[model samples]
Target: MRQERAIRTRQTILEAAAELFDEFGYEGASTTDIITRCGLTRGALYHHFPSKESIAVALVDAQSEALKAPERDLGLQSLIDLTFEYARRLQADPILRAGVRLTVEQTSFRSPGSRPYRAAEDAVYRQLQLAAQKGELLPGLDIEETTEFIVGAFTGVQLVSHVYSKRRDLLERVSAMWRLVLPGLAVPGLLLRLRVTPP
Candidate 1:
């Protein structure tokens, strides 16, 4: 019973921190602010997370997991579908939007030794490598570079959409990214052939 209560308290703290961090950003947010918003004491917050950086790491891990969930099938279409769904969810959820903004826009808060981001990067690289091995991606494409390019492009698009564009047109921005990126990364001649098909 005591263990269960502790688990619940930890989850509550994480949830509250995620919300506040999303609203105020990492540098703009503090431990006291998180505890105040959670209605928990500093001791409780410290019990779960030792520092603000730890909470940020936890949030990054959670968000990475959320983004990766739909790609479990490991097919080419699955990859594309997962990316699309992840983008859609990020655009729809304010908390996720905030997290994405922090990740792409606020470079100062990004920790170089962040375990969560490294793990997420490795997982994504493995996925891309597997896809390339299966001939889903273009032959001779550099897996690591390709993965970095895709992630970087997608992140840039999300940042632009979140910061500059109206919210209602987020989907259009996502589609435009797919139109531009998919052609270049996909197997040679495939996109051109697809474009040539009779409507």
Candidate 2:
């Protein structure tokens, strides 16, 4: 049970750090402050995370890990489901929200070449390629361009919504995003088969 307790303690630290990072950007949230927030001693915090940058890296890893779509057949719906699920999680999960913030807003804690963003793009690209193979993508659609667009549009929508209303309308904005983009991405019959409003 010692191992179990250690795991729980580590998770608590990460969660507390995420909350603080969400409230104040990465540079704003200090390791000393995080230890106090988690109600743990400095030694305990150091045992789990040697430095504040490691915590940020952990959050970025968590962000990429949380973005996968639920298991489903390879098709346009899979792509839609992946995006909608990520949107929903971003709305509800503070950890993920904070992770994205750290990835985007951190200046001092510069990671190597925006790994989190690349991971996000890769996840979407893999699914899009599968959809193409399954005959769900529009004929002559450039898979690379489509993948880039999916990641960019989603990121832009979330950033804009966060600025305007702190993401209170994220789901609605994502739904509207799909409505506008889906027509160009799929055939009419395929569009009819997809659910633009969240899966």
Candidate 3:
């Protein structure tokens, strides 16, 4: 179908762009590079993305795709699972890698730099809210504050893992992060049930 083909073409362009962005950062990767990498005509790249910034924005937005965790009970455990999923994807997904790269190097693009962080924090907040209702969270813990801290911590951990190990140790780093963070966030009993390692 035409729609299917269009969707595939758009994904192809995005993936090719993601590779370039991952390799050279946002400002370093150009439209010509994406065209050459994808072996697509200039018109095709232009048709999908009007400019390099647009492609950067698209890749940055795609960062959320890495946040897709399997459905589970909303609790501290689910939050851990969500983070582990993100770490695992960061190790393996090129699109996510590029999105993260663009997000971290936001000054290179003309898009809103905070958008991706806001989206990620929102997801964390949702899980924390549900965990609160389930009595899995620690008493008197502020969900918003905890969400912000957790997202920030994960960001830092992943950045370090990427820098030192090309993210090869990202899963282990995230597991360690949860071990340090869960005690403050989860109720003592709930902590016993939580699994920090990636599934």
Q: Total backbone clashes of model 1?
A: 0
- Estimate the TM-score of every prediction: 0.75, 0.94, 0.95
TM-score of 3: 0.95
Each model's lDDT: 0.65, 0.84, 0.86
Using TM-score as the yardstick, the better of models 1 and 2 is 2
Over the full model, what C-alpha lDDT does candidate 3 score relative to the true structure? 0.86
- Model 1, residue 135: C-alpha shift (Å): 2.6
Give the top-scoring candidate (TM-score).
Answer: 3
- Residue 143 miss distance in model 3 (angstroms): 0.7
lDDT of 2 by residue, 1-199 (tens): 9999999999999999999998988889999899989999999999999999899888878987776766676467777787778888888887898888877773888754668778888888888778878777789999888888888899999999999988888888988988999888776678777787876
Number of clashing pairs per prediction, in order: 0, 0, 0
lDDT of 3 by residue, 100-168 (tens): 887887465876568899999988988889889988888899998998999999999999998899999
Report clash pairs, candidate 2: none
lDDT of 3 at 153: 96
Backbone clash pairs for candidate 3 read none
C-alpha lDDT of residue 107 in model 2:
81
Alpha-carbon RMSD, each predicted model: 4.5, 1.4, 1.2
Flag regions of model 2 displaced more than 4 Å. none
